[model samples]
Target chain A: MAELLVYLAATLVGVAFLLALYRFFKGPSSADRVVAFDVLTIVSVTAIALVALAEGRGIYLDVALIYALLSFLGVIVVARYLERGL
Target chain B: MDIVGGLLLVGGAAFLLFGGLGLVRMPDVFNRIQAGTKATTLGTLLGLAGIACLQPDWALKLFLIGLFILFTNPISSQVLARAAHRSGARKSALTAVDRLEEDHGA
Candidate 1:
């Protein structure tokens, strides 16, 4: 059951990633692309968590943490740049 | 416990899928921000919770990730929205309010 669920979740997340990628490419404005990128990163973090579970490794969780932090900072920086020409 | 965790994981993934759909289907930048931010935040948190359940010993780290996400996601989204608005991202004709515009006196 766990195995089946893991595969199901992975498939769903993969589809979500594709959708975000589409928006990232097709977005009419930079802000829309940024929003799509944000969603992409969040979905990636969830995928990382799923990977950790599938592999039974605790170390991947730490990687997920750092990825989340960096992505948050990246988004903030980009947003600031957009707002104030920084 | 495994079944419960798996269920949660699937549920979270489902939410993420919807968020992605909304990101693609929303008519404008602000609406995309709303859909992407809110749904992904909840989905990520729930995914972390599911992982925590699956690995009881790693609950602490999972909780930390979840907490960080809860705080930062909204802040980032708000900043993005403000930036978008300030940079003149076009709004859909369906939008009926302009409170931020009024506040900015622009």
Candidate 2:
């Protein structure tokens, strides 16, 4: 039953990731693209965490944390670059 | 592990799907941020809580992720919004209620 929940979560999040990717590719404005990127990051982290559960491993939590940090860094970098006056 | 957790997991997934759909359908960047932050935050909280419910021993780690996400998601959204404003991403065609452009008008 637990594994079933994990699989369901993963599938739904995978679909969400696909949607984020669609927005990332189709967004007309730079800010739109940036938001899409941020959504993608969040989805990816969620996916990793779900995978961790299915695997019954604690290590994937560390991976999810790392992913979270990296995504934050990516947002900061992209935000700074797009700020135009920086 | 139990039905409660499963419900949370399913609910979270549904919230995520909504966020993604909203992102594509929203009118502007600001609207996008609003949808993205609220849905993702709730979805993530539900997802992590479900997992924590299953593994009682590692609840600490799961809770940590949830807390970290709660702390950071809003902060990053604020940063992004500020950057967008300071970078002049707003449209001149927008209504006059924008606080970010109040003093910058010609």
Candidate 3:
């Protein structure tokens, strides 16, 4: 059952990644692409968590945390540049 | 608790799917972000909680991940909205009400 859940999560997140890629490439504006990219980062973190669950490992949680922080900072930095015209 | 956790997971995934659908079908950028953020945040949290249900040892870390996501998703959305505003992406004409920009100009 756990294995099933893990695989399901992986598949879902993988599809999410694909959708995000479409947005990244087809975004009408820079903000659109950045937002899509941020979401892709989130989806990737979730995908890693699912992988950890499948493997029954605990270390991936830490990786998720770090990814969250890095994506947060990246999105903020990019938004700042776009907003302030810097 | 197992059943409840499973339910939460299902519900979360439903909302997540709805958000993604909204992203694809929404008329404009701001609407897409609004739809995407709320749904995905809740969806991901519930899904993570479901996984935590299976692994009691990882529950704390799961909560931490969820907390970080809750904090960041809205913050990032705000940043995106700011960028959109600066770039002059108009809200959908159907929105009918928005106070932030009104306050901004006042």
Q: Which of the numbered candidates is closest to the native, going by highest DockQ?
A: 1
Counted clashes in each candidate structure: 0, 0, 0
- Which candidate comes out best when scored by lDDT? 1
Name the 10 consecutive residues with the lowest summed lDDT in model 2 chain A: A1-10
TM-score of chain B of each: 0.95, 0.88, 0.83
> By DockQ thresholds, what CAPRI class is model 3?
acceptable
Task: Report the poorest 10 consecutive residues by lDDT, candidate 2 chain B.
Answer: B91-100
Question: For residues A1-86, what per-residue lDDT tens digits would candidate 2 score against the true structure?
Answer: 75676677778888888888999999777878889999888877778877887788879988998888888878877888777645
Better DockQ candidate (2, 3): 2
Q: Which DockQ values do the candidates obtain, in the order shown?
A: 0.90, 0.68, 0.47
Off by over 4 Å in 1: none
Interface RMSD of each: 0.7, 1.5, 2.2
Candidate 1, residue A46: CA error in Å? 0.6
DockQ result, candidate 1: 0.90
lDDT of 3 at A86: 57
Compute fnat per model.
0.88, 0.59, 0.28
Between candidates 1 and 3, which one is better according to TM-score? 1
Cα lDDT of model 2 overall? Answer: 0.81
lDDT tens string, model 3, B10-100?
Answer: 5555556666666666777888888778877887898788778877799999999999999999999998887887667756689787686
